[model samples]
Target chain A: MSLCLPYPTLMLVTDRHRSSMSLRDAVRAAVSAGVDLVQLREPDLDDAEIERIARDLIGTIGPRRLVLNGRPGLAARLGLGVHLRDGQRNADVAARGDDRLLGRSIHEAGAVVPDDPPDYVQAGNVFATRTHPDRPGRGLDWLARVVENSPVPVLAIGGIDASNVAGVLRSGCHGIGVIDAILAAADPTVATVTLRQALDRAVRDQQVADTGNHTGILGRGTMI
Target chain B: MTASPWAEDPACLRAALALYLVADPEQSVSGDLVADVAAALAGGVTCVQLRAKRLTDLDAYRLAIELAGLCRQYRVPLLVNDRLDVALAVGADGIHAGVTDLPIEVIQRLGNGRLLIGWSPESDGQISAAAADGAHYLGLGPIFGTATKVDAGEAIGLDGFADRVCHTTLPTVGIGGITSRTAASVVAAGADGVAVVGAILRSSDPRQAAWDLRAVVDAARGVRAG
Candidate 1:
């Protein structure tokens, strides 16, 4: 059997510019309501600005679950996980797997799974998302193939929110990794709970289907 | 494993899953492993998985190299069951990990990103986790129970099998004790296909055995499609 994830992972990618409140408060509230990991991704900010926000989040989100985008040196020294951008460096160097989580982003639709896959692959803007409004989102079918072919768990990102989370979960991904859904929501805590509930409810309903009458796959075989 | 780009395609994965042949060294009546797999491949087995529980690593690697060549000739994905090293060294198209083997998740995490990965999930709870963990397909069963795997637990009957099938959205193959008589029902039980060990390997004409089973499974899925 494959390694069972502790639960459906809910990661919040930090974008202070996108967040409605202070990044620290936003991360803390989301974590309290059920955000499993907080990725501090602010490339525009200088090293000092990024480090300042990361330290504040470390207290609320904890170093173990708080991931810094790039800056592998700081991540290693701070005892936290590291997330590498596309072509940043060899992922294996930063993907030290004991307790540190490693995440890689896939902006393209069908890039082959690299030789050294990360702990989790946060792939896609499955829909034309606000994050990259210009780059057309690589639809659900592409995401399905990635999920099926990937050896590591995939947390689909880009344009993800509660409204369409069930469909994302239906793609058989590990979970949803989001930014604006919680960060920019009117109530980040409530928004986080809503997404978490959608995931739990979808999983529970699927297992329940095992006991119910019909077990046919749904919608263009998306479930498969 | 040599990346079988076709195996990585979702559509191709579903097609390859349709008639999975689990070629166990212990179960093949003929001692020639390659011959048995070749015969099955010729008879329309879309996928071939080598299950060698007793062979030495070098022996397994050498045998896998031959089968990999044979499968390549047929343009079919060859999977080495529970032997990641052999699968990688020989450039087999994929690897299948059972409950006792190294977990697919750990294998994937440790840079096994090039091969198609199939998992044998043991419980209902693991069904979704298998999908989330990125297993290309699931090998679920002991569907009717058999002697090929002494430890393959009780056969989770058609009803029990369908119950588990409902728990996940991944493509799955019902394994164990499957034969021409029961392959259809196993498919009807919600499996994408059925995995057979002795049913084909033990037959004198492995080709015809695979042909007959393939016909049954295809017909069953055809009816579902209709």
Candidate 2:
């Protein structure tokens, strides 16, 4: 069976370290506000604990909407997508061929091409963030080169927020993967709405620009 | 192999090319290409192409990488001018090739048919060939003539633009000398969009410049639809 990945332009990567609420509540709120994709990235959690959170998130969000970070086997067992770190191997789990959406993280442009390409590439430290203060924001130029060369879609991750989201959209990425922008927000739902709106507006403007007809309601800027 | 997801969606492809912005850091009032581009995107420029002729390959590559991140955030497509390696190295959306650059067909193959190719064609035959060669879009003309690109050739004028647009089904964007004032004419002439350089890059406020141009394009499109 072919793997059909969800085309979510706004993705919320979870960070329990930053969230004011429980991971479940934050995920629930974010999903309610249009955070179509959620990546569970808790490195400290044991396999059992990770599975528990994954199950809970799946209960909150649908099964298809959740991805397990760095846990291909558990993800496959749960029938969810898996986001792999650079060196992690998915050879055993991926061979099962359950048609799961697979993503891999890349830091530089050259990393985009691998022997086993992923369904999508998540790249960054695109901007400076509290999560990884040691790594300077690779900036938009680096991300553009990656997007241009990658055979699959590229998702911008690391240090993304409402302020710089517009710039990221202009860089030609497939979408964004955020951690703090949603999880750390005082109101995760509102933050998710803001990011989703920015993404939707960018896409809507592009569509309006393409048709060269703005006479419709959108042209008036009355309807976002 | 499964067909790429974006390839099946025509609307996505068209949106990829709309409001194509060609940014030159040297020409920008702030002298910061990334900041200028971010501002432009904030004002609704849908696509960006970094055109840095004088910068070294290393310098250009560094800049492209940073801009790629910014463009990715907004979900816009970023193309590079005359630098296939840089585009590849940065994983940009694609490369925008001029007459002197690599042929569209060769670039497409090198990209393994993944990169979105935009070609600048001067005549009807070139336009047709480019479209047939699998160029995702065509950047046609110095519609009103300007000094932005030293070798932009002659102005195509509104009639010429209309003639060219009628000759090809590929999405076409009029480039060279277009500004908020004259952007409507290109849309009226049937071009899908407009590609600009100096008008926004050189303006005091790149953001406002982009916004004004977007407004003009939308208004013109509205008029055309009416």
Clashing pairs in 1: none
Q: Estimated TM-score per prediction?
A: 0.49, 0.54
- Across residues A1-224, which tens digit of lDDT does each residue of candidate 1 receive? 22233347788888889887888888899989988878889889887887777787777667777888888777877777778876765354543655666777865434536676677777876643456532333444456767887787888887677766766676788887899889889999999999888876665566566567355422211110
In model 1, the Cα lDDT at residue A143 comes to 66
Candidate 1 wrong stretches, greater than 4 Å: A1-224, B1-3, B223-226
Predicted complexes: DockQ each: 0.01, 0.03
lDDT of 1 by residue, B33-126 (tens): 7898877865657678988889999888888888887666444678989888898788787789877788777767653577788998887888
Scanning candidate 2 chain A in windows of ten residues, the lowest lDDT window is: A215-224
Where does candidate 2 chain B have its weakest 10-residue lDDT segment?
Answer: B1-10
Model 1 achieves a DockQ score of: 0.01
Residue A31's lDDT in candidate 2:
83
What overall lDDT, based on C-alpha atoms, would model 2 receive against the true structure?
0.76
How accurately is candidate 2 docked according to DockQ? Answer: 0.03
Which structure among the candidates has the greatest DockQ? 2
